[model samples]
Target: MSGLKRLLKKGLGLGDMAFSAGGGAINWFPGHMAAATRAIRNRLKLSDLVLEVRDARIPLSSANSDLQPLLSAKRRVVALNKKDLANPNIMHKWSGYFERCKQDCIAINAHSKGSVKKLLELVEFKLKEVICREPTLLVMVVGVPNVGKSALINSIHQIAQSQFPVQEKMKRAAVGPLPGVTQDISGFKIAQKPSIYVLDTPGVLVPSISDIETGLKLALAGSVKDSVVGEERIAQYLLAVLDTRGTPLHWKHLNNRRAEGVEYDVEENHIYNLKNLKPKRRNNPSNRCDLVYVEDLVMEVQWALHSTLTEFNGNVEDESDLESLIDLQFGALQKALKIPHKASEARLMVSKKFLTLFRTGKLGPFILDDVPDHTPVS
Candidate 1:
C-alpha cells in the first residue's frame, strides 16, 4: 500500500522522491556515469543551463570535471545533494569552494521539494536575462549515478501540480542505473518555448581507493582478502617489509617456526638472528606467505611511481635521477620478490606517466584496467 502510494504520488508529483540511491556502502563510477556524461555532452549545445549535483560528504572527490567541456558555454547551478548526512562545516567550506569557482551553489537534500524549488528559482535567476530573448530554455541536470535525479524529477512534477495530500507520504526513487534510450534521459527534458528542459542522468559513483593497501600493509591493516591476495602472499610481504626495515618479529613467527626460545621483540640479537633465518620448509604450496608480501610491495612501488609522476611539474633540477629514486624506494622488493627489474620497473614508469594523464583527465578510461568502477568502502 505504501509503495503504491509512492508510485501514485510520484506520477502526480505530490511528495518526496528517492533520487539516485547508491546500493552499496562502497561506490564506484561505472559505465552508467560515462554514458550519462556522453549524453550530457550531446545535449549541451541544445541547453542554456546546466544543473550539477554532487555528494556533500566528499565534495571535491565527487565532482566530475569531465563535464567542463559541455559546461563551457552553459551557465551552471551546483546542488550539493545529501547535505543532511555530511558535516555542516565541511559543507560550508565546499559551498565556498564552489562559489569561488563561480558556480552557483545550493546545499539541499534532494528529497525536499521546497529545496528543489529554491534551486529552480536560483537557476531561473541566473538565466532569466539570458533567456529573455529566447522562446525556450534548456536546463541540463548532471551528477554521478545514484545521486538522486529520479527523485528530483518527481519532486519537480509534484510542485508543478501544486497538490499536497494529507495521506502518508510516498517515497520516489531513481528509475535505473543508466539512462535509457527513451525520450527521457534520466528525468530531464529539452524544451522549445520560454520553456525549461531538465536532463535526467545517472548519479556519478566515484572510484574508492581506500581498500588498496599492498600485501605488506594489508597484513598490518588486516584487510587482506583471500579472493584478491591470499593470506600466504600477505604474510610473505609482511616478512619482506619487516626484513628491509630490520624488524625481526615477522621472521620469528613464520608458520610456528619460532626459534626454540625466541620472542617477537626488537632486540639486537633478534635482528641478528633474523638475518640468519631462512624458510625452514621448501616449496610448500600451503605456505605461500613470502609471495604475498612481495606482491604487496610491488603494488606499493607501482603506487609510488603513480603518485610521484602525478606530483611532478615541468622539470626538476635533477630530473634524470628519477630512475635512481625509483630504485631506492623499491629496490629491496625487486630483489626479495625476485620480480625482474625490467618488468616491474617498466610498469612503474608507465604508471607514473599514466597518473599524470589521469589527473589532467587526458587519459580517459585508460586507467580502467586497474581501477574499479565503484568507490570501495573505507
Candidate 2:
C-alpha cells in the first residue's frame, strides 16, 4: 500500500504508448462529427443555454477536451447522466466539486421523468433572463459518444410535449446503445410561449485523445467503440482497477451481511431453499430461471475475484505482478462465469460478458473518475 497513487499511475497505464483501435488512435471522429462540430460551434453563438451531458462513471474522461474551452465560456449546466449506474455515495462529492468550480451541475438518470424534470427546472432557471427578451430560446444539448444525450432529449421531449402546446408533430430522437447514432443535429421545440428549442447534436470526440488512460476510461465506459479498444483489453483494465482498489474484497463484507440476514430469516421460520434456486432448465436458454442463473453468475464472478485477490501473494502495485494476477483471475472468471472450456473464443466471450455485467451495473455501481486534487475556480 506504499504510495497507492504512484502504484495506480504506473499499473493502470498498462505500458501502452497510446490506446489503439487498429494500430492507431481510437480516433473515431467521423465526417458527420466534424461537420456537426462546426455546426454546433456556429449554433452555440445563438444558444441561450447549453446542457453538457456526461457519463456519470467517467465524468472527466468522457468530456470533449477540445470543446471545453468554448463550453466554459457559454452559459452551461453539466448534466452527469447515468447516475443510477454510478456510486450514489460519491455522487454528492462530484456535484460539490462542480459547485466549487462555480459550474451549475446535476447528476441525473436520463430515463427517469422525475430526474429529467429536475434538469429542466435548472435549465428554465438558467434561462429566466432570456425567457423575457428572446422571442425564441435555444437550449443546445451536447456530449461525447454513448453518454445518453439522445436518451435525455427524448425524455425532455416527452415532458415538454405534454406540458407545452406545440404546433409541429413531435418526433422522438434516435437512441441507441452504440456511438454515432445521431448523425445530424436536430431541434425539438419544447415550449411555445418563448418557443424554447432543444438541439440534439451528434456525439463527438476530439480528433486525438489527450491521453491513453483517458481513452481507456472512455472505452470502458462505452463512449468509444469496444472494437476500437478490444473487449479483452478493457476487461483487463477493469480487472486491474478492481484489484488495485481492492474493490472485490469489499464484496466479501456485503455478502457476509446478506448471509447474516438470511440466517436470521431462517431462524425466524422463513424457509429458503438455496440449492433449488439454481435454474432447472439449462437447455432452454430463454427459461425464466435465466434470471436466477444471472444472479448465481454474478455471485460466482464476485467470489472468484475476491478469492483471487485475497489468496494471491503478489504486489498488485507492480505491473507484471498485477498482469499475472489479472491473467489468473481471467481463468478463474471463465470458469466462474461458465464459459465453454474448449471454446476458441472463450477469452473474448468471457471479456464481453464480464464487460456487459460491469456496464449494466450487475457487477456493482462505480465511479471510474477520481476527483481532481484542485478544483479550478471558473
Candidate 3:
C-alpha cells in the first residue's frame, strides 16, 4: 500500500493530505446499502453468470470489495461501462491488466448495441455448456450506483424482444442519471426457449471504503453522490489530477497547431448559464448549449488551467501548496465559465458546471484509476 501511495503521489499527486479538509461531513454508508448487500449475496447463489459492471474511468475503485470474493468465485465478466467517457489510449492498458489477473474484461458503452452485442456473445460463450443442459439460467448484473447497470439491462431487454417476441407487455428498467435509482432487484426475461432471466440489482457499496482516495474517485465517477462528497472537493481533486499529469499543459499545443487558422467572433455575445442549481443533480437536456458554445467554453477552461499551472512556482508534493493552487483555480474557473463576478456561491457554481462538463465528456476523456502492478486476484 505504501508503494502504491508513493507511485500515485509521484504520478497523479494525491499526496498525504486527507479529503476531510475539504469540509464535507456526511454518512458514507446509508441504511439501504446494508440491506442491498445481503440481497445481492443471496441472489448470487442462484445466478449462473454475473456481469460485474464498473465505471470505465475508475475501473478498480468502482469494484464493490464486499462482494468481490463471491462475485469472482462465480462465473463472471468484468464489464467496464461508459467507455466512451474514458480515455481510449489508457483503456487497453487496463484490459491488459485484467487479462494478467485472468479475468474476462470488456470495455462497453451501454447505449451502443454494437458494443453490448459483443458482451452478450462473450456471456453465451462462457455458458455454452450450461445452455443446453439447464432448463433455467439466471444472469445477474450488479455494480456501484450510477455505473449504467440499468441502461445496459434496458438495452439487453430490447435485444431480447427482437430475438424472441413476447405477447405480454414488458416494461423497461428504470434509468436515471442519479445514483440508487433502482431500489430492488428486478428480473427481466430475455429468452423463453430455455427461460433465461436477467437480474438488475440495486447498486451497492461496502459499509466503509478502503481509503480516502478511493472514496474521492467513486464520488468523481458518480458511483457516490456529489452532495455527500461535496462538489467543491471533487472539483479540487479533479484540478489536482489535471495539474499533476500536466494535462492542461498538453492542451496548449493541441490547439496551437490550429492557432493560425481559427478565431472566435467577438460580437457573438452568447452567455450560457453557469447556474448552481442544487435541486437538479443531472445536466438538463433542455438547457444544453450548441456545439460552438460548448467548444468555446472548453477552450476557455483548458487555457485557464494551463495558464495557472504554467505561472505558479511551488512544490506539487506539498499538500498546502496544492490546496492554494486549487483556491486560485476556483477564481480562474469562475471567470472562464462566465459566472457572474458577484454571484453569492461563485465557487460552488463553478464546481457544479465544471463537473458536469467533465462527466458528460465535453472537456475531454479521462481515466482516473491507475493500473496496479500487482494484486491478489479473487
Candidate 4:
C-alpha cells in the first residue's frame, strides 16, 4: 500500500493516499431495477429517440453500460447533466471527443430554462432527419439514479408553459436529493408545434460495478445511498481527492471556542488531530473559555438525543422538538470550543459535511475518470 501511494504521488502528482475495501464486486441491483430494465426494453420500440442523462463530473462511471446493447440501434443523445458543477474546460473537450465518435452530446444544466430549451431544440432537430411522416415524437429519458432526470423534465415543462401560455401545464415530477425517488415510469407531453412526448423512468444502475472506485464515485455523488457504501468511507475518498487536487483543507469551520492557534495533519487513515492548540478566554463579560474535541462534540449530540428520546418514551413527534434538542447540544459544543457558531450551523457528522461541500461544488469541479495518456487536451 505504501509503494502504491508513492507511485500515485510521484507519477500522477496525487498526494499520498491509498484505498482499502474488502474483496468483492459492489452490487446494487434491486428487484425493481430488473423490472425497469425489462420495461425500458419493451418501451424502446415505441420511442423515437433515447435521451441518456449522465453526471458531468463522473461521466463514464455514472453511465449504465448495461444499456449499451439495448440502445445500440436507437437514436440517442447524451445529455451531461449538472454542467454548472463540472469543469467547463473538460466539458468542452468531452463534447469534441463525443463528436469524433459520432455521438450527439450536449452539456446542460438541468435547472436552467435556456439549457432545457436548447435540449428540446436539439431533440426536435435530430428527430427531423430520422422521422418525416410522424407528427409526434416519443422520447424516453433514462439514466442511473439521482442524475437530475426528474429536474430536467420539470425544467422542460416550465419553459414550454412560459413560451406557449395557451397550452396546458403538466404536473411536475417529484424531485429529491436522494436516490430512487422516482419509482415508476411516467410520460408527459410537451406543448410544442410538433408535440413531443417524454417518458420519465426511474434511475436504474447496472447489476454489478466491476471497479470499486466507480462505485465510490457514484456513492459520493448521492446516486447510491450512504447506507450501501458507508458515509465515512466516502468522506475518506473525498479527502484523498481534495488533497490530490491541491485544494486547501479549511479546518477553521471546525474550530469553535479556542482563541489559540489550531493545527492538524492528515494521516494514513485520514484522521484529523489538533496539535499545539491552546485555549484562551474571550474578553467578553462572561469570561468564558472554549475548547472542545470534535469527537466529544459528536458524542454529546448523540447522547443528548438518545437521552431525550428515552425520557420522552420515544414519542418525540414534533419536528421543532428534535431541532431544539440538536440546537441545545450544538450550543453546548460551541460554548466549550469558544468558536462563535450558530446552533443551527452545527453539522451532525464531519463526514457528511465534507461530502456536502463537494456536492455543492465548494471544493471545486472534479473529473474522476483518468484521461488517457495519449489523448490530446487543447
Candidate 5:
C-alpha cells in the first residue's frame, strides 16, 4: 500500500492530518488582485460612503483587512450577504458583536426583497446626515471575490426603481458564481431622486494571506478559484471542519447520481457513525465533538474516485491502486471536477461534490466562525 493508504488505514488522528489549521499556509495573490488593490486606493477619494460586503457564513475571514484604511476614512456599512446560508443565532450574535465595535452592520440575503428593504433603510439612516449636506451620495461597494457585491448593487437598484418609477432605469452589474468575475471598477447611478450613486469594485484580496484556515474558508466559500488550492486539499479541510463540528457529511444532499453505488446508503441520515470515536479534549468543547475518523474520509474519497474513473473506463482495486491511477489520469479527473488541469492536481472528484454541497447549502446552514455569548453593544 502507498504511504497515504497506510496513513488512512491507520486512522491518523485529526490533529495528525497534513491539512490542520497550523499546517502549511495556503496563499494566492494573482497580479490582477494586486492591481485591484491599487485601483481601490485610487478610487476611494470619489466616494462618500463605503459598503463592505462579507460572506455571512465566514464573516471574519471574508472581511479583507487590506481595505480597512481606505474604508475607515468614510462612513462604512458592513453588509453580511448570504445570511440564508448561515446560522441565524450565530448571525444575531455577529450583529451584536459588530454593534459593540461601533460599526453599522446589517445581515442580508441579497436575493430577498424584505432583506433588501432593511438594507436600504439602514443605508439611508447611516447617511441621512451626510445626504443632507450633499444631495448626491457616492457609495462605493467593496468586498472579496464572490461575496455578492454585484448582486447587492442590483438589488438596491431594483428597490430604487420600484420606489421611483420616473427615474432612469439603471443597468444591472454582471454577476457569476466564480470569483474575480467583476474585473474592473465601474459606477452605476442607483437613485435619481436623491442622486445616490454606487461604485462597484472588483473583489480584491490582500497581497498575502496570513491565516491558512481563513484562506481555506475563503476557498470553500468560492471566493478563490479551486485551481489556487487543490480540490482534494479543500475537501480534506471540509471533512476536518465538519468532523470537528460533529456535523454529518450528508451525502444524500449531493445531487450527483454517481455517488449512489458507494458503501454509504443514500437513505442514511448521516454518512458516518462518529459517535463512537474518541473525543478530542479542547479548552472549549461546547461547539465541537470528537475528530472525524480518518477511515471514513478515506472510504468516501476512494468510492468517489473509483466511480469517476469507471465513467472513463478506468479501474482500481484499493486506495493504494487508486492513488497510482489518480497520478496517471490527473487531467481526466480534473475534467471530471470541471476545473482546468494543473501540474499538482489532487484529482479527488468527491471533494468537488462535497464543496458544492456545502456551497449550495445542501449540507445545511452553518456558522463557520466561532461565536461566544457576549453583552450586546450599547
Candidate 6:
C-alpha cells in the first residue's frame, strides 16, 4: 500500500504546496480527483449558496458526497435534471422526499426553460439569508460528470438573458473551483431584476465505488440495459416491469398478429407457431402467437448483448462467442444467475470490459431494435 502511495506521488509530482496545505496525506488519491477536491473546496469560499444538480431519475446517486461536507455552511439547493425522462409520479414523490431534508428541491428539463424556472425560484429562496449582504449573488452549481450539469448552466444563463452571465464576464473566471482551470475562482453577475450570481463547478463524486452505484441507480433506472443492480439492475428491473405491462407491442398489434399469420405482427407466439409447422421442432409462425411484448424485449436485449460483444476491443474480442442460453426475459434472471447486482458486471459480460470503458466512451450507446434472437441455430 505504501509503495502504491509513493508511486502515485512520484507519478503525479504533486507540488510541495499540496502536501503542506494540511490537505491530509492521501496515500491513494488519484491525481485528477485530488485536484478536483481541492478545487471544490477553494470554490466553496467564493460562493454563498450551493446549487447541486442531480439526475432526476437518480437524485441521491448523483449527489456529490465529496462536496457534501464542504457545503455544510452554505445553503444547498438540489436541482433534478431530465425530468422528462423520469417516471413522473415518482418524480413528484422524490421532490417531496428531498423537501423533508431541508433541501430546496426543483425538477427541471435541462434542455428547456420551463423545467429550470422553478429551479431559479428555489435558488433565490435559498439565497435569502445572504442576499442582503451582497448585491451580487454567488451560487455555485455542482454535480457529477455527464449528468448534464454543464448543459444546465448553459441553459439557465441563456434563458436569464445574461442575468447570470458566466464568471468570465465578471473577471472572476480564475476563481471558480474546477480542477482543470489554472485561474483561482469564477463569479457571475445577474443581468435582470431577480438578481443572482452563478458559479458552475465540474461534476464531483464520492471517493468510494459504492457512491457511483447509488448515483447510477437513480439516473439509469429507466435507460439501463436490465436490472442487475445499480444502473443495469434497475434497467433490468424496468424491463421486467415493461414485461408485465405488456409493453413494446400495442394490444391492437398483439391481437392482429394472433388473428393473422404474420410472424412480425404477433408477439411471443412466433416460437409456438414455428414449432407447430416444423417436421422437427422448428421456428415458423403459422397462425397463432403466444407471448406478448416480453418476447420483443428478449430480442432487444439479445441484440444489445451481441453488438456489445462484437464491438469489444479487449481480450474478450478474441474469446469464443457466448453460447446461446435461456432467455433472460425477467430482471430476476440477473439475480438467478448470481451475477452481481451491478451494471459494471453486466457491462463486462455484455461488452467484455471494465465499467469505466462505458463511461470513458470506449464502448457504447448500444443500438437495439425489434430483432429475434434465435434463427434455427444454423
Q: Identify the candidate with maximal lDDT.
A: 2
Provide TM-scores for the models.
0.43, 0.87, 0.88, 0.68, 0.68, 0.51
Residue 59, candidate 6: Cα error in Å is 1.6
Candidate 4 runs further than 4 Å off: 1-23, 164-168, 249-348, 372-378
> Where is the poorest 10-residue window by lDDT in model 3?
17-26
Question: What are the runs in model 3 whose C-alpha is more than 4 Å off?
Answer: 1-26, 261-271, 274-289, 375-377
TM-score of model 1 vs. true structure: 0.43
RMSD of 2: 6.2
Off by over 4 Å in 1: 1-34, 163-193, 204-378
lDDT of 5: 0.68
Q: Order the candidate numbers by TM-score, best to worst.
A: 3, 2, 5, 4, 6, 1
lDDT of 3 by residue, 1-378 (tens): 332243334433333333333322224666777788889999899999999999999999999988988998999999999999999999999999999989999999999998999999999888888999998999999999999999999888888888887634468778877788888888878888688889999999877664667877888888788887678778877887787777888888755624667765543767565432122344653333344566777788888888888888875556666667778888899998889999998988899998988888876899999999886555
Runs in model 2 with CA error above 4 Å? 1-25, 254-288
Which residue window of length 10 is worst by lDDT in model 4? 11-20
Score each candidate by Cα lDDT.
0.45, 0.82, 0.80, 0.66, 0.68, 0.46
Please identify model 6 stretches exceeding 4 Å from their true place. 1-30, 162-187, 192-195, 211-378
- For residues 321-376, could you state the per-residue lDDT of candidate 6 as single tens digits? 11111123323344422346666655324322112222222222211111123322
**Against the true structure, candidate 3 has what lDDT?**
0.80
Rank order (by lDDT, best first): 2, 3, 5, 4, 6, 1
Residue-level error in angstroms, candidate 1, position 372: 26
Clashes of each: 35, 0, 0, 6, 0, 26
Model 1 residue 59 CA deviation in Å: 1.3
Q: Taking the tens digit of each residue's C-alpha lDDT, what string does model 4 give over 115-195?
A: 988998998888997556877789999999999999998998787677777776577899987898888899877756577
